[model samples]
Target: MSEAWNEGYFTDVGYTYGYYREINPVFQRFCLLLRGLAQPEPAEGTRHCELGFGQGVSVNIHAAANPGRYVATDFNPAHAAHARRLAAASGSEALLVDESFEQLLERDDLPQFDSISLHGIWTWVSRDNHEVIAEFARRHLKPGGIFYNSYNCFPGWSPAYPLRQLFALHDRFGVTPNGAVERVEAALKFSEALLAANPNYLKAAPQLTERLKSIATQNRHYLAHEYFNREWNCMYFTDVVDALAPAKLDWACTASPLDAVDAVNLAEPAQTFLKGVDHPILREQARDYFVNQQFRKDLYVRGAIRLSVAEQREHLLDTRFVLTQPADQVPMKVTGALGEASLQEDLYKPFIEALAADACAPKTLRRLAAGFSGMAWPVLQQIVAVLTGMGAVAPCQPESAEREARTRCRALNRHLCERARYGNEIEFLASPLTGGGISVPRFQQIFLLAREQGRKQPAEWAQFAWGMLDAQGQRILKDGKALESAEENLAELTTQAGEFAEKRLPVLKALGVV
Candidate 1:
């Protein structure tokens, strides 16, 4: 722990633009449904909390998009302010606290959370913080509540272990007293230079050299948080399970729907070997080894009451889905540990097409299945699950939360779109339909804002954005080169805006991104 930094976790530059869908209850539950797991729905005004809610993007979006009460804390007041600002902009009553984990755990007035999520911060803090978090989960999380924890795990980060240490050590002893980012940049250059020296360590770990190269191209702020931190630990699956055991939180299925399918994550031999081992935690560790899984996004439950098979089928059938992207545009090829698996066109094409048509009024699995004829419940579930996991589709929110979420989303999006004029640090907009954030790029956000302010044509939208850019002395970059002429930049913006109007406008309207 550096005496200069008061906050335990990295806060010098804050976290990068990241949104984890596992934090959204609607999407998270929908993912759980795919694995035949039962998660309690938002009935009792489902109270939720996220520890170290970086930028508060995930929690703010979740609060705005769902009809639940959210209470989240980030130690850094700066990060908390950003989260609070977004929450306020959305008119959401999300309580964002700038308090440490220990402070939060010591508070007695806080409500017990129905669900809790902490992503990317677990291994970055000291063991004391980890213990505080576990205690917080044990005390503040209600029985049967789901806990989401994502961290840099072992086997995957194995090759880069020494490289991370090298960067941190270099930054500590050699770098000038400029700031974290410059120190990180210097450390990166030093590491690359060392790799050029062709040392025995670099020879033994060829992957670390490639990792160092990749880091140089990444955001230095992100690099500062990821590798420049003093307290960083990447543990194995068993370590996480052991840490959370006192909280009575057992490992549930992974939050990723694609990972529910064994065929993709494990090789055939590994899959066969896993079947014999009945201990869930050990089995997962074994799978992690097989896939060399460096990171994990997992869902744990405290006294989970699993639904019966029939109940699961009925509930799944009742759930609805809308296509996020065009049916034809949805890539059939999905990449995972097994490399690339091709989705069967004959089966998936029709399913995707169905959702594409029903974007406005998404169809349930049972209703959608009727069109395919003879598609059984399990197969339908699998296909939809896989598609949702592939990021092509999303589950539709209940009608009760729809109007309220939309109102909040509209308010929040208006503020976000306004921010796009300056820069695109945030790359997500709250989607009322899915009760989650949608990946809307900066330009699209500007276009949506233009449309909202009476710019009917794409040319007009392009002109409006170009005016802002020119006024700010910002030029559009193409192929790592800025367009010298204003006319050339506007021409490029016009072409992109035109495509957005023709192709994406309808989908945005249907999904309520605008």
Candidate 2:
């Protein structure tokens, strides 16, 4: 709790309980294969390390859902305690510690990790810490291993830099309470008032007005850490590559599946221009300017490996995918720098419907393409890529891995569902099939608990949930207003439970969460 231990990092408020899918090894491998790059194979002894694993949600989920060893650390003791508790409940055997990056670097007991990841930590720390991280990666990352990192980047943040500076200045000079939330509220109020005064700076940068308005609507806890941090830096793509050079890291591809699809992200002219740019690093950084990219999720490798066309095709056929949402409900369009583009329903619909069959089961590209006679292999591949980018589908682990991870997944899911009875802070459940967290809301988790307790009908499940809620003086909200009577709350809950049983329960069952 001491400020000295926090170094420049924000510790007055805890980080959000968010589950980032990019940290999952199964997703990382799929992203690599999409770009014709070699990835670390999913094996029984795979090891992963995460730096600054806030709330430990993603690390815990991955440890329980995948057959591997996970070692992670967050400097905040509160975060480490929460993460360790989840690991214990799942029986995941993860090693979580509350040590700073420099402290972690001094340890001698860590294994050579197949993957090393840090999300949203690169830009918020000092340059010395960055050096520590690069040195840590250099010492612990195995040859040909993957390194995942996400950070706020340049060009997109160029105009918004002044706005953040103003916030930091106000937090330093303005009268405010000691609490992080209070400081954030006061800074936002000052910024809003300053924008209303029509200053000359606002005249030069018109976009800051709208951006500040949007920032005001975000989670206060998120805004506190994001804007009020003591040390903040943004870099260009080339700068990041240079920073990690000591680790012998080469840029591989983006962890975001959508970035791999040029058709969606780049205009024809932009694509042609990028093709003419010979340097890979220059081309990637140039592409960012066209899109005004602020945030990036990137993948780097110790030693880059290029896959041949024949091998790429062979791997595609063997990889499996599963629908994360309902087939019919999936959007027929994807948005990117080019704006919204419509997907060919004739191509995507049949593929989605096939996977949705047999209770939304997982299927390989070879088995799926067999159903369609004349579809080309490239087209099928693109379909999967686009669907994955839209978050409607996810790459799945092999059956052997899923079977081995099922017990751990079940234990974590049970623990999460039981916690849902008290609060809705965490809203994801581990899935053995996907080797990642799936978005299952709090009420749905409550329904899962009801079913496990032998409640069969929707009415029975609703009644069970109501008893838990009513005991704590909680009421269901309808149309943004709390239902005043128990009857109204029960009716609303029953309707929701009925829809859950019909639509979501089947998918959860297939994911082995039910």
lDDT of each residue in 1-514, candidate 2, tens digit only: 4569888678888999999999999999999999999877878898999999999999999999998899999999999999999999999999999999999999999999999999999989999999999999999999999999999999989988988898889988889778888899999999999989999988779999999999999999998889888889899988999999999999999988888788888988999999999999999999999888999899999999999988888887898889888777899999987899999998899999999998898889889989986998778888888999888999999899999899999999999999999999889999999999999999999999999999999899999999999999999988999998999999999999999988888888888777
lDDT of 1 by residue, 43-94 (tens): 6378999998888888888899888789999887888989999999999889
Give TM per candidate. 0.96, 0.98
What's the distance in Å from true for residue 196, model 2?
Answer: 1.5
Off by over 4 Å in 2: none
Residue pair clashes in candidate 2: none
Question: Where does candidate 1 have its weakest 10-residue lDDT segment?
Answer: 1-10
- Give me the candidate number with maximum TM-score: 2
Misplaced by over 4 Å in model 1 are: 1-8
Which ten residues in a row are the worst by lDDT in model 2? Answer: 1-10
Candidate 2 lDDT for residue 160: 87
